[model samples]
Target chain A: MDYQRKYEKSENKNIKKISIIKYIICVIIIPTVIFIGTKLFDGKKYAFLTAVVVLLSCVPFIISFEKGKNSTEKMVILAVMIALSVFGRYCFSMIPHFKPITAITVITGIYMGGEMGFLCGALAAVLSNFIFGQGPWTPFQMLAWGMTGLIAGLLSRYLKKYMVALAAYGAVSGIIYSMIMDIWSAMWQDGVFNIKRYVACIISGIPTTATYIVSNIIFLLILARPVGRKLERVKLKADIIEKD
Target chain B: MNDKMKIFNTYHPLGLFIYFASAIVITMFMINPVMLTIAIISGIAFVLTLTDIRTFLKNLAYEIPFFILIALTNPLFSHNGVTPLFFLNGNAVTLEAVLYGLDMGIMILGVIYWCKCYSIIVDSEKFIYLFGKAIPKLSLVLSMALKFVPVFKRQYRKISDAQKCFGYYATDSYFDKIRNALRVFSCLITWSLESSIDTSVAMKAKGYGLKGRTHFHNFRFHIRDLFLIAVTLFMDIVVFTGIGTDIIDFRFYPKITQINLNAESIAVYGAFIILMFMPAFLEIKEKIKWKYYVERI
Candidate 1:
């Protein structure tokens, strides 16, 4: 029994070490390499490189989620959350650029673990875009929303304590999403990255960005309390996710 | 209903997936006039064949303003190139910028059309099959979420109706209506998350995530798929080599240089045209085969 316990302890340490390495490579190394590649490479390659780098940044979170020994209930709950966001999109379709998706994603991240939060936000992009339309911008949307959820989950403890911080984070994420998408527009326009054109795109996109910020803040303030409580209740009742 | 799908979609999912991925990516990289024209033309042709004429025209009509917006916006912001077309708000709207803007717009159009074709060809089922073997868990999550979208939407309607019956939405005040709408939303989260336990149990009972899990899918990798993939990859390599080697140059900055096509560029250009029109070639061949059989009949 002692031997088995020691073996398990070493194996757990190894797993933790591997995950840290994965994060370093995925989050830090790959992006740095892509940044260098973008500089060295000629005009249009950066467009493809950006797409690849953003997609690769998303892979670690997804791979870790898949690798974890998770329950089916978590998957089902994630499905439900994603569905709720998509339904939210339908509810507010009349309004342009204003969506409750970011707020809902953050709330889920607060309740669920970071990985499930990332999955919810990312899958919500894919699932909803399947109905709307998939474009070159889809990958960027996934990255933006996924990071929102991942960061929200990481900062859940702090955000859950203060509603103002949660709303602030939502507003910031909206800006990030809008900026990331603007990078795509600039790249698309110039076929090369031009600072002047990118700035123009940002300026043109201000109205949309403002709408995103306003909608995210409103939705976060309203939905956080009810959704977070419900998630806590649901997670607690799910048995496998119950904390001591 | 039977003819709702196109000939391109009948191939294995892997081939179709690779085709669209490479096609879309390469089209985005291309700024050469010849290549972009081929891409845009074939894209329109593919979309036309994908859907009916009226729908295609309607989509194109809707896209024109956006296309023009993308085109004209470049001159406003970008004052590149030597030849000044006009002065707009003290910014010299150069010919290069206008042309570059139009190029960007065409490139964007090609991508959008390809995406439209991709959405038509690659349904959720095919998406599940494509990723299911490689990334089972994520695919399962995607599948589950896709399935739940409609179910949740239905339940939302049901709950909203019940609330309406209770005179929840009868209030004239906008704030009250908003509050009541949120309550319905809260009620949705509760009911769905609570029932997810049973859903998960039912799935667990069916051996989900178990070892030796058999996945049922309609796609089968055939020799034709192998041929399609090989051709697609081969063309993509040629296009990449041409682009990487800086052979097919079409620059629209400072001075719009008249492109002098070398032997390599011509070869690459021919390859891209063939690459873009493969679906058209296949559809025509199918039509010819049907004609021959019908005549014999």
Candidate 2:
């Protein structure tokens, strides 16, 4: 019995040690896997698979949380967050504006944080594609957009005028998103990642990029003052609610 | 095992993984349209089985406006394809292009519906359980964001009802409705921002970004999970093979490929739908458990 107990304890310790090592490997390998996987496919299908892989690869990292949360509350929060993320993505297609995606993602990131930003960006692409149409590129769209949100969230800590930063990021990522998407398209459809095609894709996206920039600047310019002020007021109220 | 499901239910997680896998494999392998259609329909049917037929229809109803817009706009912008149907102000409208648009429209609607099924069944906690460890900051953000929605929704409802009480009639025209929507959205944004700051502060106080942050999750590897992983992996291989071999060739243009409409597609779709409704199935099972408990008393 004593021998068995010792063996079990040692095994548990070994598992813990391995898990940390696995996480470190994951951090390094994840982006590489996504880059390669995306390069292998094209369009919406490629995008969809990339997103799935990214989500799956993160599994080991998610398993390390401590237990005993308010289960119902936690579940409810998760549902709402996902819905928001999905809806955020959906609205990007439906809402007619150049900067709708960037504006929403940045604002959401500032308020919600990086993970939600990732979900929002990734899901918005996937969900919006349902309206635009799903194809081999859906996952890539998710990743491109999700990365925007994730970056915005990371930057929010440093930027006081979060909206302006968001607009700038949005404009840059808008171009980046199309460029990356085009590279994926070149790979899948042509079976070769063509620089000419990549350039052509980016050139084609100029109108959309311009629209995005204008929209982001205008949206942030208008929204930042009133919205930021109101948010400050609400924070005071939430503080009371939390204390109670 | 078949009882009212708590958050710990494995079925939903299994289904989530399946959804991810299928979405990946289907796109990667270039599965036939016939099979894709089968997968889409089966997913819907599975959702119907879990929720009421009426509820399913109602949920679909919400997507109609968006669907129409996508269908209409695609053709206006994309003037490609052969076999022009007519000339609208010297612009050609081709049969092939319209069909292409329709195909895209259907695909889009199908994906949205599938995602809805995924969201309804899995929820945030399960998603967090699956993703929280590797990306703890991201997980917390997602959890907080999810928690924030209904609070905003409830507050919006209260505010709108109050407006109605004061004779602020909300409906007049589409533009008016839009105006009201903007108002509500701005308010919601305000609320979210405030709460976000508070949440961030709270998290920081709790040592959120301290070195070596830890997570606690309770996931067990049971026979069922193994079964799911094995089955999905096998199906993925088969689906890819079907695509690679042109056994289920689905064409988008002038040429159309036929599928056998037989066992393989049907079975794959059947399993897909079941995976979607695993959450609802667990819920129903829970109700049955409560009923059995009362009966025993």
Candidate 3:
């Protein structure tokens, strides 16, 4: 039993080491792409650059999913989280910018870990776009929300410990989502990332940003505890089923 | 609704994928006025052949506004180039900006139309086949998620009804309504996660995601499909070469660049025209052949 425990600890450490390597590689790729993107690309190219960015950002999560020992239950849970988020988007489609998508995505990340969270966020963006008429903004939407989930999952422990942290994270997530989306607006307008154009886009979309912040906070605060409890039960339930 | 009515259905999924991918990528890369215009016109013209007039017109109704919105929005934010056309909020809404906006709109519209054609032709089943081998897990997830959306939508209705029965939701007070809605959402989340356990068990029992899995695809790459693919490849190469050599280059910044109508430009344009309008031509040919056979019979 002692031997088994020691072996497991070593295995866990190895896994952690591998994940760090994975992240470092993924991190290196993104800034390189961005650096090249800024240097080489101009108007019309930014749209494709954003698309390339989406692909590069998503590949790591997908690679992790492929490599990891993700059970069927976890996959289902991720799908369910995405479905719930998409449903949330559908429910409040009549109300502009008022969506539980960010809250749900954040909660998903917190429960499912960073990789699943990223997939959840990105897939939700893709699925919602499918439902809501895909446009030029779809890739950016995926990038923003996918990163939101990724960061939330990575910082899940701290957020879980403190209510204020969770709320603050939720607000920050909204800002991040808004800022990333406005990148598209800036790029689409002038074919490059001009600060003047970007700020103008942001200023114009202030109402949207406010709505995102409000909805994210409201939904996160209301749904976090319950969703966390449910996800815990779900984890337990999966374990029980797996034993059978 | 008839598959015979459209030529898009006849090609193999690989052929279809290559065509659409090349078309969209080519259209996206170029900011040339003439090139973008060709793309938009071809997309519209090709899509018209595939879909019915009424539905196309209905889609067009919103699409026109979308195009206009993108076009106008471009000028609003962008203050690039010489030749100021007008002043909007202490910014020069220059001619370059205006023209650029129009080009972006055209490019966006072209992509949308081609994608619409793609979606209409390549159903989820075909998509699964196309991407299944390359990204098996992602494809599985996509198929599973697509399946689950409707399943969960039904579940949502069931949960909402039960919640309403318990006086949980379906109230008038705004804050209360929002609270009640969240409760229903919470309830659904629990049910969904609970059900996911059962789904995973069921999927495992059925031996999903097992190694040595064989996927059944009825997509036989016939000679005609190969022919279509070859032509698409040839045209794509020609067009890409045009872009690479700056033969098809037209700019709309500072001042709109004059369109070159030389041999290289014409070759580039010809390749693009053939590629984009291939489906329409094929559909017309098919219709004529079908009519001739019917008349003979």
Better of 1 and 3 by TM-score: 1
Encode model 3's per-residue lDDT on B1-297: one tens digit a residue: 674457678679999888888888788787777878888888887788777789899998998998898788777766778999878889999988888888888887888897777666776667778878766776677667777778777877787788788776466877776676677777788877888888899989989877787877788888988998899999999988887778877777667778999987998899888988888788778879989999999
lDDT per residue for candidate 1 within A1-244, as digits (tens), equals: 9988996787677668659868897779897877787665655547767777777777777766666556898888888888888888877765787678888888888878677778888889988888888887777889889888988989988999998898899889989989988998887665568888788889989999999999999899988998888877777777755331
Tens digit per residue, CA lDDT, model 2, A150-194: 776788765445554655665676677777677665444323344
Model 3 interface Cα RMSD in Å: 2.2
True A-B contacts kept by model 1: 0.76
What stretches of model 3 exceed 4 Å from their correct place? A1-44, A240-244, B1-6, B50-61, B69-93, B166-180, B283-297
lDDT string for model 3 (A53-75, tens) is 76676666666665555678877
Highest TM-score, which number? 1
After aligning candidate 3 to the native by TM-score, how far in Å is the CA of B258 from where it should be? 2.0
For all candidates, state DockQ relative to the true structure: 0.72, 0.12, 0.50
lDDT: the better of candidates 2 and 3: 3
Model 1 TM-score on a 0 to 1 scale: 0.91
- The CAPRI classification for model 2 reads as incorrect
Please report, in order, the local distance difference test score of every candidate based on alpha carbons.
0.83, 0.55, 0.79
* Error at B26, model 3, angstroms: 1.0
* Model 3 accuracy (lDDT, Cα): 0.79
